[model samples]
Target: MLSAVLLSVLAVAGQEPPRDCARPNGHLETVACYGERREQVEADQRVILSRINARLDQLPAEGGVNPQQAKQSLEQAQSHWAAFVAADCRAGEALFGEGAAFALDSLDCEITHYQARNRQLAAFEARYGGA
Candidate 1:
């Protein structure tokens, strides 16, 4: 049963596959594209995080808010957010059951979380001043 489902997913993904991710063919293809998009978002997040870190490093302890403490807080928030995203994706997979559908659902959740995080970082930069 699993093999049959896998083969079907492969067939759908391969059949007249789109040249770009904008038009994915099936659950498998969409999942692949989502994975690519997630990677790109993560890369962007890294660059943004570095800029934010640099800005944080320049700020002195004003009003009892230490620069090191601020940096640590940001790190802890990001770490916890990542764990939540992973757990959410796992929940999505379980919701969809055992198949390619499950994989696609998980990828969808991941892409959503990555995009949301990137937006959050952008907003943070806007508020705190960063590239």
Candidate 2:
């Protein structure tokens, strides 16, 4: 009964077949899943950033915020955000220590950050768009 329930949960969470993250059998499997997820999320971040940059380029200077200023601001904000993600994730991982829960928790933490940042960026684009 437990196995069936777990399997269903995994299936709903992800198919991650290539890395078997949905039903990871070992540490390596989870590691692979985390790496792949991180890469995919980072790629998404890059795409959104490109879109934001294009939008910034289109909007004229307003309230002393120009394209160059917006780009520079984004770069600065991203640097701080990247650092925060790293520190927060690492601290959580360290507190969790090495175990069955470690990788999963770490992965969840990372995904949460990426998802939150994406949402924030989307909202910004929808709103003022740094203009």
Best by TM-score: 1
Candidate 2 stretches with Cα past 4 Å from truth are 1-21, 62-65, 129-131
Single out the weakest 10-residue window by summed lDDT for candidate 1: 1-10
- Against the unseen true structure, what C-alpha lDDT does each candidate score? 0.74, 0.73
Give candidate 2's error at residue 22 in angstroms: 3.7
TM-score of 1: 0.76
Q: How many clashes in each structure?
A: 0, 0
Model 1 regions more than 4 Å off? 1-19, 25-27, 62-65
Alpha-carbon shift of residue 94 in model 1 (angstroms): 0.9
| Top lDDT model | 1
TM-score of each: 0.76, 0.71
Q: With candidate 1 superimposed using the best TM-score fit, by how many Å does residue 97's alpha carbon deviate from the native?
A: 2.0
